[model samples]
Target: METTHGAEHVHVGRDGWLFLTAGSNNVVGQFSRSRLMARRVRGWRRLVVARVRGCERLGCRYLHVIVPEKLTVYDHKLSAGLRVKVRLSPALRLRRALFWHRSARRACLDLVGAFRAVRDARDLYFRTDSHWSFAGCDTAYRLICAACGAVPKDLSGEPQEWRQMAGDLGSKLTPPQSERWPIRGLQRDAVRVHASPIVELRERTGRADKLHVGAHVIYRNDAAGTDPRRVVLFGDSYAHFAPIMLTALIAETFAEVHFVWSSSLDWGYVERVRPDLVIGQVAERFMFELPDDRFDLKAYAAERFGTELAEAEAKSARKPGKNSDKSPGKKPGKAGTSVAGP
Candidate 1:
């Protein structure tokens, strides 16, 4: 296998595969056995313990999921020139650390093992993009359902179409590479009931990437056979609020599903929603930083985009006899709603 360095951030592997060796999170450097990396792993263990205890106090079941990066799952595709060791991945280190903690051990999901078992079967992640494909998302979804003790919804029969696109990793190259990947249909049984103000503003201005940090949304499924439990998911792009990925899959299976696009858990929001299950999902690279679980979605949006949001609302109010019904700077849905999808 021949591997070439394409861009400063991308590692071009054989057979049209692209791996992200460097990015904002310093993907390859995170594998070091340095003292700092060890401390980071310890912090993750503490965070897991706190999450479990916090959920227990709120009378909800919490499941922590760390979505492995492309390099962790597809290391075999890499060229011998790449010297990073997959075994040194932070995700594995964190999992090993959490294994000793009683409560945290059970809360954390072992996705690395799950992904490795089926890595040779098919392409779990996208060839050009840093995110997972429909197949990869489905594998994680099934594992999530089993952990929650909820019956999984089979979306295999859903209509699918392949579209040409350059994913996040592919776009970083000097000569961008593109691929045709399968796109699944929207959730048949679930409908978006509400979207937060930031979400609306992002859609209006076509600046999803910029305004994605605190996005949130809600989906309701009234199907007869769906699970009765309510689910709150604090995740990044992989389990987005969109109907094409992990959020959509969970929404279709449960009565109500709330998707919060933040790596940090908002304790206040969790208490208010009172969901039966709380899920925290983050990309493996993001494990480099530990969150304090104090993220307030509404306060964050206001502080970050106060002026822009106000201007947008004023513009909408100025339209011919259009009166703004949404509360000033408040999310539009029932209580809590924001958005995320990539």
Candidate 2:
């Protein structure tokens, strides 16, 4: 089934899965302006590497998952006439940068290729939502686990349900107060995935870049698991769906799971918790937006761990002439530098 709306950003596709057309510009990334250029996209990939390196320093394993635009996966289902007109930007394909770049190959997980490999009667993405359907989420989760060297679970035993829903893109087409776009969920995860309320925070006070400074989420999974490593996941809304099943499996698999929902790249949270595994994810479209999120990890470490690291700096800042190095009664021996008595 193919349908067109006056709003080009929102296009109706087979079986009602709405897609964000090229002009939507609203989808996620600012990449279309860059046309996924190899030189430009490669620069973004390096920014991602810098963040991943911070996790590696903590002895934590990293998996970077990038979600491709929905149309790339199921363009076959798109209406006949508009099909030929739509093409993915080179960056979305990722073949030239992350896929082939040895520098990022280890940490990068190919979500686009992973989604393409599977053939499901139901669409990989949702008809009514901007996110992946439960099935698509399943594929992403399993691939992530596999990439991390963890065995995937048998979800077959889990319970299931179905419901009718409207997707975000479709909702854009509806009249205000209208019933909203309605789509059906044929197969849904039946096991209850109830997350406690999100813990919100604005990181590194007074950051200049608005995109880098914004609300982030923290989700703690109380469920018990034998895996001792605490896990911290960072991403936008895309991170929300990918981890639901991982939490269910992790509700009992890991010691505890924490989520940081933001595009800003900071290692302070990782430093505070010292998680055993760290995973950062983002949509492919937003890959170009990463450079703005960059920060000096060394400064973040000093600023964030100030109280814990030392009292000298804080005490010195408070008093202009005081000898911060000297103990209560100890004398400064050499040019104001405290030293053990000779």
Candidate 3:
């Protein structure tokens, strides 16, 4: 993790890169490709210039700043479902192609398991909007419980209900261009997931990794006492689930669990935390964001693994098979010399 100018750090993963942005500026690339395309292309340039020129003509220089402010407030009011509806369709074909790629398919399986875990626990997702479907979250929650050796709660015995709570996240994404994708408001009914009280071992502090939180704040019962166990989690939304899910699962295994993300874990954090097991998880399409110049995944992994596993794999690959002449106990025979060769 590279510390930025503002005491903030950038997180890179084994197969991922860290793209650092300026202060208080959100990393918008976490969305679908259409959103990224719209923000980075010439189309966005024209849109911005036009707005700036319009503001100049009105002699309201601050209007340039006000436009973004207005849009951000507008987006904050909308739900990710509405935002995704508008944001994903334009890139549907691209996303579909990505979803079919071998790597992408593998990624989805990892995520699907995570989703399944959440659902099996009778907790789908937030009732107001954003994040995974309550159904999707159930899948993730279950996978984690199993992985951590925790006894999973049965969905059949848990009854889920929903109540509308006022949320401000949807209105926060104000894209500059009107030619952009469709955006919408948060849903009126969201799933209210209920589970055992999370034991928050570490008090929730603002200093604790913000990148790990992303759009959702996870809570756990930390009162279980402290014992250090190693955990490696990867992905955007997928990685975020690890902290909350494992806090539950770890209770069954290690007394304390160290949570790290592929997206945000820097070499520094790895060196400092020194977790025993590392997990890498993410959505299928996230690979597109892997080429940031700011982070070194190779160095990070090298530090984390300490060159042992790499050397072990190389050694194992060189061992001779039973049929190979190079086998220590087997002697080489001529083509027709063997008893069965004739």
**In model 2, where do residues sit more than 4 Å from their true spots?**
1-6, 22-39, 81-95, 99-103, 155-161, 174-225, 241-252, 291-342
Off by over 4 Å in 1: 1-6, 324-342
Give the Cα lDDT of each candidate: 0.83, 0.52, 0.31
Per-candidate TM vs. native? 0.91, 0.64, 0.33
lDDT of 2 by residue, 79-173 (tens): 75555212444335444456655646767777777787783564566676667655776677788777766655555343344444555666566
User: Lowest summed-lDDT stretch of 10 residues in model 1?
Assistant: 333-342
lDDT of 3 by residue, 1-342 (tens): 233243231222112112221223333332445555444333322322443343334332211000011111122233333232223322222334334343322222233223333333532433222233433434554555554454444332223344333222222222110111112222112111211011111122232333332221212222343323433332354334333332333332432233333443343333443444333343323333432222344454346544544454455457765333232222233232111110
How much does candidate 3 score in TM-score?
0.33
RMSD of each: 3.6, 12.2, 22.1
Tens digit of per-residue lDDT, candidate 1, span 1-342? 222364767888878898988767888889899888899999998888999999999999899999998888888888768867878888888888887786788788888899999998988998998899878888999999898888887887644777888898887775778898777875899878777767767876777666567778888787899898889999988987667789999999998899988999999999988999999999999988887698887788779878887888888887887668854434334343333321
Q: After superposition, how far is residue 35 of candidate 2 from its true place, in Å?
A: 6.5
Q: Please list the residue runs of candidate 3 whose C-alpha ends up more than 4 Å from where it truly belongs after superposition.
A: 1-123, 133-135, 144-163, 168-229, 234-255, 271-274, 282-288, 291-342
TM-score of 1: 0.91
Best lDDT goes to which candidate?
1
Q: Give the better candidate number (1 or 3) by lDDT.
A: 1
Report lDDT (Cα) of residue 229, candidate 1.
89
